[model samples]
Target: MRIRDTGDLWWKNAVIYCLDVETFMDWDDDGIGDFGGLVQRIDHLADLGVTCLWLMPFYPTADLDDGYDIKDFLGVDPRLGDVSDFVELIRTARDRGIRVIADLVVNHTSDQHPWFKAARRSKDSPYRDFYVWRADEPPPTHDEVMFPDEEQGIWTYDEQAGEWYRHRFYRHQPDLNTANPQVRDAIAKSIGYWMQLGLSGFRVDAVPYFVSGTADDHADGLDDPHDLLRELRGFLGRRRGDAILMGEVNVPYEEQRRYFGVETRTGDEDDVQGPVGQELTLQLDFNAMQYLFLSLARQDVAPLVDTLRARPAIPRDTQWATFLRSHDELTLDRLTDEERQEIFAAFGPEPHMQIFDRGLRRRLPPMLDGDPRRLRNAYSLLFALPGTPVLFYGEEIGMGENLDVPGRLSVRTPMQWTAERNAGFSRAQPRRLVAPPPDGGYAPEHVNVADQRRDPDSMYTFMQMLIRRYRECPELGWGEVEILEQPEPSVLAMRSTWQDASMVTLHNIGPEATTVTLELDDIPADTRLVDLLQNGEQVIGKDGKVEVTLDSYGYRWLRISRPESRRLL
Candidate 1:
């Protein structure tokens, strides 16, 4: 049971690139992306300094929820490629020291899945218990529903079975009865299957709903809601102790701790992190992401400060996944209506761009109006935060979205490779391609890797430089954060220290120039400030404080160095 790992702790400081295989590239003329194209493009990721690849759901599906409605948990989609192509892709990625992760969508499956189909056919079917079904009509009204834009209710009646089935998301995806023992075994089987196929871990979807039932919710003899998650943790640990399990639990910030399980040694009596790992290795910091948008809109740092203070302590081994955008909409559900409206007015002025009254269906560059200084400032804050940063594909070159593509699909267009047919993503005709690629200013003709790679000031080059600098400073990923108090509310500053290494970052969130002095008593009096982001150097003042003047949206990253410790690692 004590399997040894590389002990690289790679996930902590990793720069993850998330992409959908089907929209990434298409080598065949089938008008869809395939693994053959992905295998050939592994070198591009390696060149970008990517450490991990987070693949969207590629399992067999019924064209529902963009493959999240998994129909076959153990097989790859035939449209993408055969099993051998997946193996070759993983092998190719491994050769460059990159690890791959996939989505584990266990919350629900397509209603057409064999288990669900068989269960709905007869009440006596062995698989009947695999899904949650009620003999009586469900409650007329209920909360705790997702996809309110598309789903009318949480429970839908099934005439064939003469009962109601529960679904947290789309009606086509019926929630699995995770409390059942056989269902738990089936989940374990899925984990083992992918691990054996060379995947490093999985991005667990809808985690809270996985354990939604209460004491009375399971009258058919099932384990407690918490047991299933604990079992999944133990199962993965037995096979590979360093396995990563990233969860997406969209709940209140305080409630997220339950999903990030506590890992403590027996009789230790301490909730602090230890060698033993628990439920989730990393959870997306939705609270911080949502608050950051508020801070951006108001040009104030109070929201960010509050979010930091409210952050519950996590196990030392566990980390957070921070991102500017992902496959789904940018969620603002945690903010108040007034706050949400203010942000909507500032970033998403268009009515159709805002969706479900809780999210923005546009990309970051478009929201910022393609301002280069603001772009650098916004992304600088993202990378400086206390988490592993994730970059959505094509964002390095500042790709925009297609508003007319419908729903969240507006942001899920194919990757723009160059200024060619189909934006160099595929050779297929425009009508047969995936979600339409941007055609105007953000089209491949104007913005793409081929053009940005040669420009020194392009976002692509900036990212390469940023990643190299990030890898040199391990403290950003594992350090303790302390917010520095400043007189100006629009200026944000913080100090991050890990052991003997210490660095300070400052940013002007507003549109006006600002001059602020940060008091520092812990640093040595003789220390000098060496800018890590290629800025000039400056000496500490006699008052034990440093003063700097910043233009609108300007930022600085300075490392505290005492002559002997001034060089970058």
Candidate 2:
């Protein structure tokens, strides 16, 4: 799994696994997951076909806003082990074919940081300009503040400095002033420190909030953040030639191209688009996921297909990191309240939806009780989608959301390795769970790695089989996607071909059984189609028409090739 061995070397065919190190493993029984604990799980990740491990922030923090409130960029959070532990985890993961990507929070630092402490002491301090501050007037009020209920505004007044500093997120996490040359240089040096340690890459958090406009204006302005990103990329590129630096630029799809340094029309007056430097390796496809979820809940597959067809063509080297669940909010803001209510009505009170505040919570289901078959169909769609797939920590074992717990902590529960006490996560008492279950009832039988591994029909096994099959066919890894225009709206059909082999993924997502007729006029006359999921259960007519009978939500990947060509080979 050397970086150079892969074609694009980006997350092209990579399967990423997201882990919250603070809550992932607890090796010392202190009720906190540490790097040594993560190092212990390296083999599990490799066995699960994970090529890259994207860890949430593991830096020194105040523990108020999870790990996002960084107190020290150079040091690891003591609760999650020290520098030695991180280095060991990196070496262990790399040896097991896993590239580790850490979270880089450049937008802000914790108020507890030494630099912030020095800046707060005096307005004339050398570190005063490290963060965005205004002495003449209050800081800008961007749109409606992110936490209006919790805070009065985006800027907080400092009595000592007699000025207000900008903060896009929590007030404790003050936004860094990227406009300052010294601040930029210091951040670059911090990145270089990690690069020198042989870490794979980074996931830049809240990249667009690096700079700000006026107090009355919420606009981000025409100046792309690429100037800062490019400077960081250039410095890192010089040191580590092929390492990646993905930005969490969660903007509109049209604005995504700018991250790749491509200038295009933004449909606004006097707002010409400019390039944001950096290869634009990956942009989280929230729009695509939104469209898919909406279509599924409404039972209208046309919109999903149309959205995929209308997607802007990205560079061959670029890729979308697809996921059904991640460490973020589950319900995206793209959907209207009406749509959300409709889904809740149909799905019948999902645990995560109980406290879902305007769609700002992420949680997994405890079990596939309602529609296990439909869940399997969704998994099929995820794996067959045209992007690198990312599996959330407990998704493989059908881990459910404990909505009883507050915030996104419910979704960040420990990995259920066994049905033992604490689900084999920690040796601590049941009441000591960092994210305790709402009702104090553990889902020992329903959600555990040992039980699922022994069950062949488990979601974990299904995912493993799909990944193994995908690896067996290199065409599916890197090939052109040609979606077939099928008459049946509920069926998703696509073809991936390379050289002499062609792979067709057909899925029936509808509630009723359907038969798909595929004309072989375009294909070779002697071509033989082999169903990988259902062995030899296919019928091909002499009139060059292949009829496939699929059960409700059934899917199959057909390996189509000429019989004579296969025999000769």
Candidate 3:
């Protein structure tokens, strides 16, 4: 039993909710969501039990790449309101105990950015080196192009600069030269500026591309990239002791661990104080998410269990950020072709439903065929997993995607607050919206917060229940996780224990109802498994064995209890 309720580790038991302001709500009826709209909707998030709000980029942009191609890192887009509106949003969100974090997209900048504009003017410009450039014509690195349909290679020739610049993403956005001390300082300044303006932290975008150097970069750029992360972490700590940097690093588990800060030994190898993570505080768990999909496709728990066991241990303070769908596509690049095919066949059977040849552009509701039981079961499993659960906007209401929207924008449609015109997202005409609200059975008419709020059995209500249960059971986030042994392959039974508190969660992903047997040898002679979801309780007799029946796609959270057990003050 261990107690870990310290001030610096709030993220250990926090629930993160991600949203894009452009599509979240349009308060001014200008066909775009603004900070004013977000401020008005703070109560909705508070009601949903979100501890942290991970906001997508709202900085001044060229309107390319869905705000990722940032033109000014410090200025707010006029259409989305000014600095005053942003400050008001932060103040309002904080009033509800919801900390806000915005996107730190330093990996690249829009070509229209002032720095990029000046850099292209002359070779002697100081900003010229701020971006990666090669004077000589580089060979075709066709494989490096991120968007195969749009880009032919990673290097795009700049006519004004007479040099080829590198862009790992799109041609309109050029990768920054992080190796340059001045650029690093600029990025740090931007981070500090936002923190001073009330941002709790940042969701670092494209962390790998931001830190790693490429062949076209300067000679010194190839040096250890992790050093930048260490510096950023140190800077963040000095500014705000509790501020966190949640990076988007999509790579293999072995490689991804390095982003959390590698363990280094001092002069004495046997020192009592071991090395700890000194870099990013949290990272998106791409590995477990991919395996989760695989497990769902097979309707077996083996894949998820294997991946969970394979996860490398990180420093106690550092944690994983888990999610089902994000603002972007649901990527499955880590999985093999055969496994990827299985998931595609199960969730994304249509060609239009897939993207990047490695991911799905659709949201979860349509993928699961809008089955209420399975939806609740999967979400329950997500909240029960050993990490901080992150929900994309409208996930609580089970929003669907619009296939008519090209590329990743399919999942970036407007939020449906009601069944009114334009889903009540805006007063403007439907055609003038940022993106049309999804159509079909999953449209606002059928699925919306207004309707769900009235129905007790709706997805929105179920998510609220799941979130309440997750927040109540801190063990799920800060406990020792164990994959309990069970006979049914379709069922996954796991236990999380922290201090004197213990909880066991079981989920059945298959279509058929089944019974699962569990042996709790360490339990007391006359103990009971208290159902946290309801009033029912199951007694574990002297034999230390318990049998529980589960309906198809059913789930349960049970707490180990003894007759003498009592709550502590």
Please name the candidate that would achieve the greatest TM-score relative to the true structure.
Answer: 3
Question: Model 3, stretches more than 4 Å misplaced?
Answer: 1-7, 211-222, 264-275
Candidate 2 Cα outliers beyond 4 Å, as residue runs: 1-10, 136-142, 147-149, 212-223, 263-277, 347-357, 360-370, 437-442, 499-501, 537-544, 564-569
lDDT of 2 by residue, 145-168 (tens): 555445666788888778888888
Q: Could you tell me every candidate's TM-score relative to the true structure? A: 0.95, 0.89, 0.96
Clashes of each: 0, 4, 0
Order the numbered candidates by lDDT, best leading. 3, 1, 2
Please write out the lDDT profile of model 1 over residues 70-171, one tens digit for every residue.
999999899899889999999999999889999998888999899999999999999888888877877754456777778778889998988888888889
Candidate numbers sorted by TM-score from highest down: 3, 1, 2
Candidate 1 displacement at residue 333 in angstroms: 0.7
Judging by lDDT against the true structure, name the best candidate.
3
List candidate 1 segments past 4 Å from native: 1-7, 211-223, 263-273, 566-569
- By summed lDDT, which 10 consecutive residues of candidate 3 come out lowest? 266-275
For residues 1-569, could you state the per-residue lDDT of candidate 3 as single tens digits? 23544335889889999999989899999999988888888899999899999999999999889999999998999999999999999999999999999999988999999999999999999998889888898898879877876888889999999999999899999998887888889999998999998888999988887734554554664445688888888988889989999999998888888898857466442221333788888999999999999999999999999999988777788889988889989999899999999999999999999988999999999999989888888999998999989999999999999999999999999989999998888999878899998888988999888999899888888888788888888789888899998778899999998878888899999999999887888897668898887668788868888888899998989988866768421
lDDT of 2 at 488: 88
Overlapping backbone residue pairs in candidate 2 total 4
